[model samples]
Target chain A: MIDLVSDPWPLVYVGITLGVTALLAYVAKLLIWGMMRQSNPQITIAAQRLGVSIVWLVGGVVAVQELGVSIDVLLLVIGLLGVATIVALRQPLENFGAKYFADVYTPFKLGDTVRVGEHEGRVIEINAMSTVLLSKGDALVSLPNSAFLRQPVVNLTPQAWKEVVVPITLPGTMDLAAFENTMHRAIARMRVRLDRRYPPIFTVKSRTAQSTDLLLTVMVRRPEDRDPVLAEVNLRLTEAMEKAPASASRAASGASAVDPGH
Target chain B: MHSVDSRWGHDAGTAAEPREEDRDLFSDPEAATLATTAVPAEGRMNAVSVLINTQTPLLQFPRAPRGRHAMWEVESNFSRLVEGEDYRFSPGGVSRMVYPLARRMLTEGVWSDVHWVSLNSHGPEMVRLPGGITLHNVTIQPEHLGGYGKAKEAIWSTVHGLNSPRSSRDLFWTDDYGEYTYYNRVTAELIRELDLAHDFDLFYIHDFQQLPIGQMLGTIKPKLFRWHIPFDSRKIPAQWRPLISTYLNSYDVVVVSSERYRGALRRFGHRGPVRRMYPCIDPAEYKRAGPDDIGAVTTKFGIGPNDTVVLVVARMDPAKAQDRVIGAVARLLPRFPRLRLVLVGNGSFTSASSGLGIPKSRTWRRHLEETAASRGVHDRVVFTGHVSQSELESLYERCAFTVLPSVREGFGLVVVESWLYHKPTVVSVRAGIADLVTDGENGLLFDPDRPRALDRQMLRLLRDSGPLSRKLGEAGHQTARLCTLDAAVRDEVRLSGELGEN
Candidate 1:
């Protein structure tokens, strides 16, 4: 058997693979940290996990090459598997993507009366695959997420024009009280355009170990200002999430400092 | 007077005589219907989720900067506080009466989830109190603090019938009004968020400062508003009436402290379910002090053993009618030379720098001192300036009788305190407590507006050493039972259950 450890070419290949893998892992971690610091923790963690798995996959191939395995056939097999998986899970993936977009963009929410296509009823639920509505005639209408994109939906909720709902996802580790405080202070800056009677409200929708989902709702005084207000609110939401962890840590430290006994 | 008689005594057909315009105005069914339904069911228990709001928090800590503690972390219960040093229970009707009622409802499991949002500038963002109660604090900027103070003062003055109606219209349009609205808006927003989480059964809002919160909340949930101030329809400006009524109509039920206030609300055209609930205090909190305790308290205030202590336990404000007590004391000084007047309280949270930053207390106290000096009764007056509860009890025990001389008091809790101590009280006619007092029977009732009513009442109490004082004290104690927490808890639990049924 050849002493592969002594060979210069094999040693160089091993070093290159290990070095690149470590560098890639570090870079991926940094990106994840930045995203988690700036965006929703759920999104950041999801992206991070995906990035780490991809880096490990590529690193494994490099390591195999160092061990003198043929790479062409392996690449072909992986590509074929990827294509097959994509084709099989297309519908679920589409529905998931639609749900994500609907959370951010859809004006009508659960409990709101909405009209989409031939269906008109109070929106009872908004699930991953369909938006459920209870019709006036006691029939349940389940519309696909794709229909919301294709059809023109009219929200019949009184003062629906004034309502702006923003979806927020926070990491389980993030302190809710701190996040709420920062969000309140951030939204207060936009009080000029927002209706004084109806201030911004954040309602917790659901919670899991990975993330806590909340809906941020604000009412605008003028109909024309909705789009601008939505954009501004989104921008603030992004900023608040980014600033939250550090501010939360700072607040915690400040509290502890003020209360030494604690 | 004849018109009044004709309208009330005759039938609809007979009432319509000669005045065709009046008949036509009364004949419109739609207008009449609107008038009758204008107030709506303000008092109906609508089985709705509620949000209770007040300025003072239900729970307060003795120490400052209670940082980084969990919402449930309470180191010491209210009993641990040494009344004056560690913490002083917040004064005024809201803290004394309103909070206990809310707590009782929660304890009785009448309310689904009672969320109290308050202005605790010094406390945490949120405190999860006992019985699933959550306290939300609203913080205002220091710069806007002064403006907010001025705005609340204006509203207070207007509601108490002190400010002229002409000046009140401008109040809604001022920059201070914006800040005032900002505080209320933030509170409303908080309540809205909480409602989305807990889906509360109803919103029971208290105090005059939080009046706009009902309109701002915009929830279809049953809202019960309790106005804890003197509501005089005649005092409200004509231009301000529509706006005030708009806010009042937002509530399903509008509760006032007195029937007099209910009538005033009707005159102001608040056609809602206006109910009268007399403010109450927890009698369990008051204990009769021993003679030694009384001596210790009076000695601290430099009250000699021979001196007759006349106590007035009220915040240092012109509205409290402290000047009336001072004037009455000055008048009776020559006759009863040993009489020592001990004014108990200082400024409220609004007048404190750590709180709302209002200076009315300081100004009013200064005016009072000047009046005392000018009248040559400064030597006899003892401004104890915010005594502890124990000290207050001692003073109540040591004094001949107590007086609530407010020009317009919402309800007098001090008289109730005097009653709890089995001490006779001389109450101002303007106080809501006067409704409970039957002149010389339970407690003395005197018109605050009269120049010598308070003086004569003071003399009457001073000269009487016979069974009359003891008889009045016993009767006053009986009246005090009507305003105790035990009675209040029963009424509040019943009200909460009734609301849940609706």
Candidate 2:
């Protein structure tokens, strides 16, 4: 702590440096969010975290230097702490990292009857570290998320291959009806490649005061058309978001091709 | 001499005097029946708020004048407006059936707060009628309405067996379907907003146009759907089965117009309780006009005193099969020299300029006129489009018999109306009301598809006009009791109570 009775120049400089660091961190988050708006929401969020951390790290060193503290020692201490924490929490960190990748690549979701390796059951819950399933014998089985990446999983749902679920995060202040209408009009143009029997539908997953989570599902006419249809749908959805009012915070995740479970 | 009522948001003492006709419009019809009917006492229910939705609005307003904008954004009170000039009550099941049932239920305290939402593009955003019922209007963009109308009309035609299933099998994937979903989504969002404010206990959705609403609502509250159109499981396209079944299963209970439809719903894979409630009307809404009233309407239609009039009351639509009746009448003209056919009603809400603006009604009417002309009976056939309530009563009083020639009718309520007038009716075998008609007892049934079946049935009434007609008419009047407001109120109250318990 700086003594207030002495010269106040150093203290003012330290306060100014910290305040500017906070402003820069917010700007960095918005910039990263804008740059990766079309990418997976997880990657955008992670990038934002990295950008904020860098800004704070550099500004923190400059602020500490104004207080007559050495910056080298602090950097060395933080680097060692980060390394030790990663080593100690290796299992959980691995599971956590696997959860992110599995979320992007996994074909099965909750309520789906899936067979992973030697286990066959219905998915009941998916957490950060593990996936819970209920067996046919009414037994609950917990499997680490990392194991999903290592095993081959088979989805047993009928016509599950036709499902393409696109997750969207819309600002609460934005009009849901208008957005849905716009997206519907956009998706309708691609009906030639979609299943003629199952129209595109939007299902609300959850909502908060700040944002609403929605899943848009469209069925593909041919099994081979799933990948291209999803990519086109994501592109159209991104264009729709860009055209919307700037007041809305746009965040649409990568398409998750899975059984929507009707 | 004025009373203080806060419901109208006006000082009654200084308010404009309501017209005499307005008083007659607001007169409670249930009070006359409540004395004899077995309605539950007041406060039987827990005063739950209910939400009602339909595609047809309760009232149809006239178009705004040129260079003048209508104040549709403001809330309107029906009591302060004139009937014909300001707004006219829509003429269909909404006006003749749903409105009276809602008013009667409110009178009996079965429902406390009722909010009705409908698709009214030109009407006010909100309107307050008497008896605690509020109407909310939902409008879609003009550009989108065409696609929505096309999709709904296709479903209507498919269900009525007028079109091949293969023709519209891929309707769900068309861009028009997206517009249909847009309309439903907008309505659902508005309903959700209302639900958040009122905490509705139940949602009652009506007819096929709103079939997807139950699935879109995303509410925990119980939903009841009433299908007003003919439902034949075999007529539904295979491609529509999954979506239709999903929508049906979303509702807690599905109510159909007849037991036949209820069975068909079950066959369609609906995993929910189904109720068979007959389409009803208020007997009090009709009156037996005197000689002068009958003579005035007859002269207006150029009916001679010696002519024996046969009436067919249906909107101008192909499914109604007005041409079938015209052909039958042409054949009957040789046997009965004084035979005259009077076709009543013009169009439904869907065909109105203020509504979907579909030209089906106009095209069907022109086709009907051509058919009559080709049969060389244009001089004998009279098309009196959309008669008033009293005029319809006068026509009912003057007619010798009525015919329901629909190719496929959900439930022929016009037969019930004719029965109320104690007039003999020849109903089609395809109608749901045929189940209620015993052969040679209450009414006569004819297969519309059979070439001369309707002509033979009509000859039975024309040959022996005294005793046989009287016997059939008297027994038919008794059958009408099963489909009146009193009977409907009891079933509806029980349904509401059941939903409350669950």
Candidate 3:
């Protein structure tokens, strides 16, 4: 008891804390995947925030023991470092975050002509750094994604007001044919507002072993209803992904009864 | 002489002059010497590798196998079952015209190996027929089957001038359009896969149903598209021009059945190489039935010798305009009491249960029956659903003359069939065969829409006695020679060589 201050129990506590933090971080990843099985973007973002916070918390404790300092001093130093980092990378980080949100919320996409601030041109490319637009005179103009958050942006292409683009990511194991059929049937249910001449087009942008990126374009009758339509489209896509396998199984079984000419 | 030769040479250099016809013909000394030095080989061991595609398959088994045996296993060897028992030749233009060309090409050594790809839902995956010909079947799901059917029907109706532009406006944007694209894509994929294995020298695609296939294939190989239907630019909608032109331009050459169709294709803005090759059948296949064959067919149909038969051999579809023929017969029944109108053929492969399963043919046939009944000529008209080739040949021989009353025809091959049998035919002016017909010369032409045009033509043929009928039938026979398999094979081979060059 007299030498309690000099005992190694505090270091042991820090080690225990770090171990728990590491374990929690791994568990949180699994939980995030399970909870976001339907691919809810908010759940993914929140899970990522929790994971980073846990990493920093564990690092703080480890730093305190190595410096021969108290946990309190380490936390103060860490907080200052985080504040300095945030301050230094504020604009870029904000733009990056805005781009993430814009991917899900923005009505216009690459190849779409849009007016943001004083710039109006066809979007040639959308990169993590910025969105580049090509003017009629063939001049390239780059705009930071964060500008979309602060300024009033308007899509200028004719009938672009009616366009709503949805970005979707699907697992590689999922059958594309089945998914396409299910998505078509699901989208057909919302045929009232959609222009019949331009039925929803689902284009595969990129694909990999783990996942595939797809763009779904639909033309709406009214310009003001874009937001609500997007939410519905996203919900329908998730529901379709869930319901497609069963329908595909039925089709496969039915096709088996009759020869598929294979 | 030297001064004169020099002056001549100088004059040739200074003068812009017209060349003599014989000189142009023998302009190249090497070619002229080769032509003169060598007796042109009358025949050679020539081998042609061809890829053939049509909406209709060459062979459709009458029934799907009872058990779990695969079609591939069944079709590869026809020895497992009898020919007439297991499968019957699919009748109509495909079996009549296209099959004979392929078969004759193989037999005559014009083509060595033939790969025929077609839409076959209930066929074996692959069939190896006689004469080293292989059949590749393209299959689609039943759910998409309906969509494909609707899309093709829309296209057919639009092209035939049956549907209004407003009704067919959304044809390219629906889910059915996707299925249509899927079917074409599936066919293209099959062709590409076969090309990978066989490396065909030429590709010949037939009919409007497969119009997009040439474009979808996107291959560097020679692609030839045969627009087997009438291609009237006036009938086409403004919205569809771009897409149709785009597809048509994909082919290295476009072949139509008649000069009129060729002109129509040009009007449709197809700047590609276009040729008019008459659709033909093997004249040798039309077996000359003796008295016994005719008696058997007449007995089977329960028609007496005194009955004046006005035969129409067409599929039971509304577009064939059987009702117009019936109306003409109804009007003639009062003048000639012994007239019997015989309508041949039933539903197509599309209407059959084992195929795409569209019921348009049944519905259209029912409507025709109702029209005959309403017109009070039900007993006078015979609805012979489907007949064998022997029965058909007998019917053609027994009839005084035939009438092709289609509102719009691809090319009245049946008229050519009648001509093959040496029977006079009254053809619709709307038919592609109208290009070949001179009124009252080889065959008669009548406007299908005009009130008494068909009746007038029927009366003209029926009232004629010895010389007129004989003269018309003989003239028609001469025209039939131009569209015979022998002529078609030569043209096809020549066209194939030309297409292969570039």
Score each candidate by Cα lDDT. Answer: 0.71, 0.80, 0.74
Q: Please report the candidate that would top TM-score against the real structure.
A: 2
Candidate 3 chain A, run of 10 with poorest lDDT: A249-258
Candidate 3 clashes between residue pairs 3 or more apart in a chain or in different chains: none
DockQ per candidate, 2 decimals: 0.03, 0.23, 0.10
User: In what order do the candidates fall by lDDT, top score first?
Assistant: 2, 3, 1
Write the residue-wise lDDT of candidate 2 on B232-285 in tens digits.
Answer: 999999988877987888899999988889889888878799998888887656
Top lDDT model: 2
On a 0 to 100 scale, what is the lDDT of residue A94 in model 1?
76
- Candidate 2's TM-score on the B chain: 0.92
Looking at candidate 1, what is the lDDT of residue B306? 89
Task: Give the residue spans of candidate 1 off by over 4 A.
Answer: A1-262, B1-50, B59-88
Instruction: Please compute the TM-score of chain B alone for each predicted structure, in the order given.
Output: 0.85, 0.92, 0.89
Docking level for model 2: incorrect
